[model samples]
Target: MGRILLAVVALLLPAHAQEWRLTRSQSLTQEGTRAWRYTLSPADRAGRELWQKLVLQYQDHLRAGYRVDLGSWRLYFLGGRLRLEPHCPQVNPACFTFGALPVEKGVQDRFLLGLSQLLDQALAQARNTGGNLTLSGLFRVELKPGQAPPYLARPSGWAP
Candidate 1:
């Protein structure tokens, strides 16, 4: 009975278990404006699929102004770029708005263009080699000197 239950539970789990990670974070200048670049990578197959789906649906999401939930992070399309914020639960009484990492419009546009090309290349590579491919996004965050940078939460099961 224990064996059967374990098998059932295992069947319910995702085939590709993966989580997103902060692969890169650094300060940079864009169009003479101070900014920070935050790159999130999906270190495995599951994460790659999730990121790809989000990119594919980006146009529709942007048009509808929908908020996308990625692990503990919330994504908002604002001012012509993607903004990152911490996800707050509706039942949490202490929920409040924290500052977000806002990407510049020009920078966002260029990134998206490059991402499209990368995806196309990945598709070709996947067809040639029966291996999985992954992708990451580099977000250009506008810096407000007086305020603190937004806190990026560690997803469940993530270790430093």
Candidate 2:
């Protein structure tokens, strides 16, 4: 296990340095307008090495509506995702969106909290590791920016 972990960590490091911040986060507005945003965070210390894992994220949401009358509102659904990361992989690369959240929504960012449930199908075991081409959460944005963020890990022996 240690050898595999060392090899993986070594593979993660490249000649160029990587940014360790989250950005391009978006949300909804009260007037029914779309609001896009982002956040950046970094830590500098030499305590627990694991505590210094760099994390970058991007999230976007769109919500548009017209209130011709209060009784009923008009909403046209048109929302997807666009992410770009020249420094790192689009996804966390090491993160596997499986298992369950260890903590509740502690921070204000709450858009992608429940989104994990949408990817629960990937949690099932198949005939082989690569038996099926599971999405494996490569397409799911499962957490929003907040004080209580989602776990960067999974339970002991879970594979997806």
Candidate 3:
């Protein structure tokens, strides 16, 4: 739903890109029906975008899923963020088709998270070989001050 995406966006984005070090971390939690998480530490804009794509995709599968005999099914790829309505061949309802929605550009913090969720949903629907899927590593974006034309000061002897 649009509200779900909006709520996640509003609840996550931060307005300070100057100080802290951006961190990208993921944790896997297996509970009632295996739940996992992939997120960025010191997270920023890009991460959020990735997460958004994932959530919309996850929802698409859930909405479009239908079991003819209650077990076998066909999984549909719902692109990125869900639009006004999605249409799947199996499901006639407009909502079934998670259309092409406007994904926020600079939301990096949550992007990976969304991406992870999407992958998980895909794995679930996909009857292929999939068990140990991972999105691992530290992601960083730096913004440091550069030396000026006049105020440039050379390193005054290296200090420990």
Q: Which is the winner by TM-score between candidate 1 and candidate 3?
A: 1
Question: Comparing candidate 1 with candidate 2, which one achieves the higher TM-score?
Answer: 1
Report the lDDT of model 2 for residue 6.
49
Q: Compare candidates 1 and 2 on lDDT and give the better one.
A: 1
Candidate 3: TM-score? 0.20
Candidate 2 has an lDDT of 0.23
* Per-candidate alpha-carbon RMSD to the true structure: 16.4, 20.1, 21.7
Candidate 2 residue-wise lDDT, 27-141, digit = tens: 5677773433222222123211211221101111111221111011111122222221112122222232222333333211111221122122122221112122112222222
- Could you tell me every candidate's TM-score relative to the true structure? 0.36, 0.17, 0.20
User: What would the per-residue lDDT of candidate 1 be over residues 49-160, giving only the tens digit for each residue?
Assistant: 6445545554345347775443323556666556555454221112211112244443332233333333333334333432323334323333333433242222122111
Per model, how many backbone clashes are there? Answer: 0, 3, 27
lDDT of 3 by residue, 49-139 (tens): 4435543454444446421110011222234211211122221112122324465433332332333234333334221321222222211
- Candidate 3 at 49: error in angstroms? 3.3
Candidate 3's displacement at residue 63, Å, is: 2.9
* Deviating ranges (above 4 Å) for candidate 3: 1-43, 66-99, 103-160
